[model samples]
Target: MKLSEVISIVDGALITANADLDMDISSACGADLMSDVLTHARSGAVLLTGLTNPQVVRTAEMAEIVAIVFVRGKRPPLETILLAEEKGIPLVTTKSTMFKACGCLFQAGMNSCDV
Candidate 1:
């Protein structure tokens, strides 16, 4: 699914890269540890996490993640959002827990390699 499609399906807001709503999201990776994300996330993947630190954005950038979904009602810091804007990374906040968010997207046809 495309990034915009995921946002539409999950009711996610664009925290950054509003212009990049059309970017492709071929997969997803859910983890709280930035290290795991950096090691395993594929290109153009959406990262789901509850960590709200700037390091999360940095890890996503390094791994080339397509988008980020903050679960459990978490939100990244303003500086992190600004950096994401500069890097053109799409970020979203959801009330759903990490497991539910990932499950919802998966049930809606997203996958770790679903496409």
Candidate 2:
């Protein structure tokens, strides 16, 4: 699925203005634990999480995630956003809980990175 479609699926707002909205994301991983994300998330996957810190951005970068969706209407700090922007990762915020957001994306045909 495209990043734009993911945004629509989760009813999220894209906070990364300069990032590519048309990026193709084949899978997603929803986790708040950076360690779990690092262990299981696939490259080019979208990371859905409630944690909004520089560490999350760093983890996404290290994992080569395509984008990030901050669940429960949570927004990252300016420093984190700046880091994401510098890394060229799209950032989104949704009012849905982590489970709901993941479900919506799954219903829209995006698979989980559960290999």
Backbone clash total for model 2 is 0
Clashing pairs in 1: none
The top-ranked prediction according to TM-score is 2
Q: What does candidate 1's lDDT look like per residue over 53-111, in tens digits?
A: 88888999999997889988777889889988888887898888888888888899787
For 8-98, candidate 2 gives per-residue lDDT tens digits of 9999999976978788998999999999999999999999999999999999999989899999999899998999999999899999999
RMSD of every prediction: 2.0, 0.6
List where candidate 1 sits over 4 angstroms from the true fold. Answer: 113-115
lDDT of 2: 0.94
lDDT of model 1 at residue 56? 88
Model 2 residue 97 CA deviation in Å: 0.5
Cα miss at 65, model 2 (Å)? Answer: 0.7
